[model samples]
Target chain A: MTELLKVTGLSRRFAGGGLFRKRKVFHAVSDVSFTLKRGQILGIVGESGCGKSTLARLVLRLIDASEGQVTFDGVDMASLPRRELRRLRQRMQLVFQDPYSAIDPRYSVRDALLEPFKVQGVKLGSPDEKVASLLDMVGLNTSLARSYPHQLSGGQKQRVGIARALALNPSLVVLDEPTASLDVSVQAQIVSLLERLRHELGLTYLFISHDLGLVRYFCDQVLVMYLGRVVEVMPSDAEPAHPYTRALLDSSFEPDPRQRRTITRLSGEVPSGYDLPAGCAFANRCPRVSDLCRGVLAPLSTLPNGQQVACHNPLIDAALPAACR
Target chain B: MLLTVDMLRIRFGAFSPVDQVTLGVDRGEILGVVGESGSGKSLTATAIMGLLPRIGGQVAGGSIRFDGTDLVDLPESQMRRLRGGRIALITQNPMTSLDPMMRIGPQIDQAARLHLGLGRSAARARSLDLMADLRIPDPASVYDLFPHQLSGGMKQRIVIAMALAGDPELLIADEPTTALDVTVQAQIVQILVDLVRQRGLGLILITHDMGVVAQACDRVAVMYCGRVVELARVDALFEHPRHPYTQALIRCIPRNGMARGTMTAIPGMVPTGMTQPPGCRFNPRCARVESRCRVDIPELLVGPSGNGVACHLAEAA
Candidate 1:
């Protein structure tokens, strides 16, 4: 598979403190590196304040990164000129969490779809025809184009949001918690729509969400983040070997009672981003934390079958799963 | 039964949001009220807490008996005494539910002071103990901190602490962990389940997540468009969901072994206040809907196993 995006050692640090006080440097996205192949969905799973959202922004160049390189389609996005970067934005798009807030209150469905084209400076053959076709592509009725966002259902509004993301025929879509606000049935519809669209349109997706079950089911590969670091990266179908990943998987409540598993409850809370520990960020909460784990940084190392894990003691052996091999 | 709600109907003026909902909770049991948005699960919970009037709702018809006391006709003064004393509510968003100006200690202590009628010192001690019970590290420090000062999980723990301070016989948690992350959500659910077991308090957990129901609840009531479509034990509900709505809900969630493109999406949107169907509310979206389902309203009927279903086709299942 051809590589669509390559990120190396990307990091973003935010400094906050009173004018005279000691400045606190928060390592939001610390030394994260990953590659996305064309037509592949890479899911980033993490809890709040884990910098999943920050990594998404850094990749799209929506926010400046403190360190590392973001090469999109072999072009370094950071060093690109302002005009060139704006032009490059047409190839990458984002769908935010809340459909209600992501869209303009005053703009109609047609206007919302058309707004993307106008901003991207892409001239369509016919704006009306394009808008209606966009609505149809996302499974919305053509008649609803004239309606405001408030008049539409949550699912319909999200369809509109998806349509707007696809307005410029972008190759990569960064969907940040797209289904988090919608109802489960609606979430199902949206997930199905995204899957179909990705296949039909040959699009790559960077799906950032807190829902582990959905990520495992939908993503081609999963990247588990903890406290601004990539703790585990595995094939979607493979069982994770990191304790943090296992804890996250165990934490998710499955719908089937027969498959009910006890949650490996992690003691203590997520540490403050500003005052992160000197060792591994997740050492305090890791079930297998030892003296060495608490004092030394755990390096992300590749296993035999290419699944990368960052832990002193991995759950599964290096003998890879058959499917992954 | 610690609390029994029989055919409880909640109406906002002419539009009824909760219609003919019947469910009960036993001491030390967690009854999950599961549904989507606008499914009226929250309304039913608030109705039980005698809080429907606050949201411009009234108990149109039905009986809410708390240990044999009919709460429907009870006067406001009497209801006020019952609320926060025997029945406490835990709302969805702790950030919004909690007062930003007040410290966590005072906010939690106030519940004990009012409901338990404890002295200032007693309330403080009780609140701190509740916080500790919730596994909030450094309860003493957290007591003095503001709501904003704590994390989302910490804030929710404080909310749970306040709810427990009343020593309520029934705790109504409406989407308690919806705002929390998965790891934190697990912690909160564990805390709630432990509380139910220890205190033997009847818990009405209102959530849109079937996963939570499977993990935490003893029994489950599936709601759709203001109606209890199915009610059964959590294990039975997942194993053999009778109602079409309940079946569809189970199919929609991404289970562990589910493959891509296998997660079925229930077609058609949930009916609203204006477009509500005359007969079976879920018939339009139900895959097993029959001709009779389109015109006849299904009553909540009990099966041989004591499980209930409100569907014309449920008899065959």
Candidate 2:
């Protein structure tokens, strides 16, 4: 499989304070790297303030990376000129976290969906036909095109957001917690719709969410992030390597009442971005932290089946082995 | 029984927010109420505490008998006295529940002083002790700090401490852990479980997560569309859920070790509050829906070992 998106050594920082006062720098994302193949769903799972959304924004070039290289189909995305980047934007679209805020309240669903085409200076002869088709693709009725966002339900609005994202027929779409605000049944419908769209349109996705179960279900590969760094990257079916990843997996709340809860509780608060500690960011909360882990930053090491983990003492023992070991 | 809700029905205008929902909580028992958003789980808790919003929802029918007193018919002044002194509620968003302008110690101490009738100095001392018990590091420092200065987890602990300050016999925790992170969620659950056990308080835990219910609740009541569809021992309900809605809800959750794209979700959306289906509200979404389910509302039929299910199929079976 060829890579559609490749990110290497991505770093983002924010500097603040007045002229007299000392400037403080916050490392929001640090040395993050990953590859998303064409038509593949890459899941980025992390808690709030972990820079998951920041990484997504960096990939979209919504915010310029402080230092890094982003290659989209072998083209340098970060270094591209504004005009070139604008053209590339049609190929790579982003679906925001909140549908209510993402779409303009002043515009109807048809206008919202057509905004992308209008921006690209590609005027469709029959705008209504294109809008209706996009609505149908996302399982919405053609009549919905006339409705405003406030008139529609949360699920219906999200469908409109998806239709708008697909207006340009982009090859890659970045969905940030698409179903977080939706009802359980509606969430299921949206997930199925995404799966169907992926199969039908051959769309590649970077699905970012805090939901572990949803990530494990929808993604082909999963990336565990903590404090702006990828702790572990593995195939969805493969056993997780890092303890943080394992803890995340274990802590996920299951719906089945029959299933016994096996949550491995991790203590300590998430360290502030303004004052991050040296070495491993997860060392403070890790249950099996050692002196070596506290002193040195762990590098990504490959295991069998192409899984990679970033930890001095990776949780190899916790990983369920071959034939349920 | 510490608390008993019998055929309770809450209405807002012509709409029924909670329809004839009946359940009981014994002394020292954790009764978990599991359902999705707008399922009336929160409304049921509010009704129990006599804190239902005045404008819309009102106790139109039935009774809430807590310790042999009908709380629904109680005077406002009496209910206000019972609100924190005998029965306390910890809502989902602790940030909104706690006063932002006040320091943690003063807010917590206020509850102790008003409910427990303790002096100012004694209440302050008790508040600090409660904060320490909740594992808030540097209790003295945290006491002086405002609510905004603390983390989400710490703010939640302060709320829990305030709820416990009154030493209430019954604690209604409505989605207490939904706003918390997973790691912090586990810790909060542990604290609540330990507290309930130590004090022998009846706990009514209302949440959307079934996992939380399974871990903490001894008995479980599954609510849907403002009604208790099933009630049973935790183990029994998990082993064999009688109601179709209960089964569907369990199936909807994405489980670990399941293959990608293999999750089974219940079809159709939760019906809006203004217009619910006539017969069984879940009939439209249920896979096992029969003709009888669409026309007649099923009564709570007793099953094996006191387990109860409100379903036409279960009644026939």
Best by lDDT: 1
Please list the C-alpha lDDT of all candidates, in the order they appear.
0.89, 0.86
Candidate 2 displacement at residue A209 in angstroms: 0.7
Report the lDDT tens digits of candidate 2 across residue range B1-317: 88988788998878787886878898899999988888899889878878776655789999999999999989999999989878999999998679998988999998789988999999989998999888888898899999999888889999999998988999999999998877778778878888888889999999888778878888998889988899888887777888988887766667777775666677777887677887898889989988988999877764555568898888543
> lDDT tens string, model 2, A194-292?
998999999999999998778988899999889899999988877778988877767776655566564555677788888888879889999879998
Residue A295 accuracy (lDDT) in model 2:
83
Supply every candidate's count of residue pairs whose N, Cα or C atoms clash at under 3 angstroms.
0, 0
10 residues in a row with least lDDT, candidate 2 chain A: A316-325
Quote fnat for model 2: 0.55
Stretches of candidate 1 above 4 Å error?
A18-21, A99-102, A318-325, B303-305
Fnat, model by model in order, equals 0.84, 0.55
iRMS of candidate 1, Å: 1.0
RMSD to native, candidate 1: 2.1
Choose the strongest candidate by DockQ.
1
Clashing pairs in 2: none
lDDT of 1: 0.89
Per-model TM values vs. the true structure: 0.96, 0.95
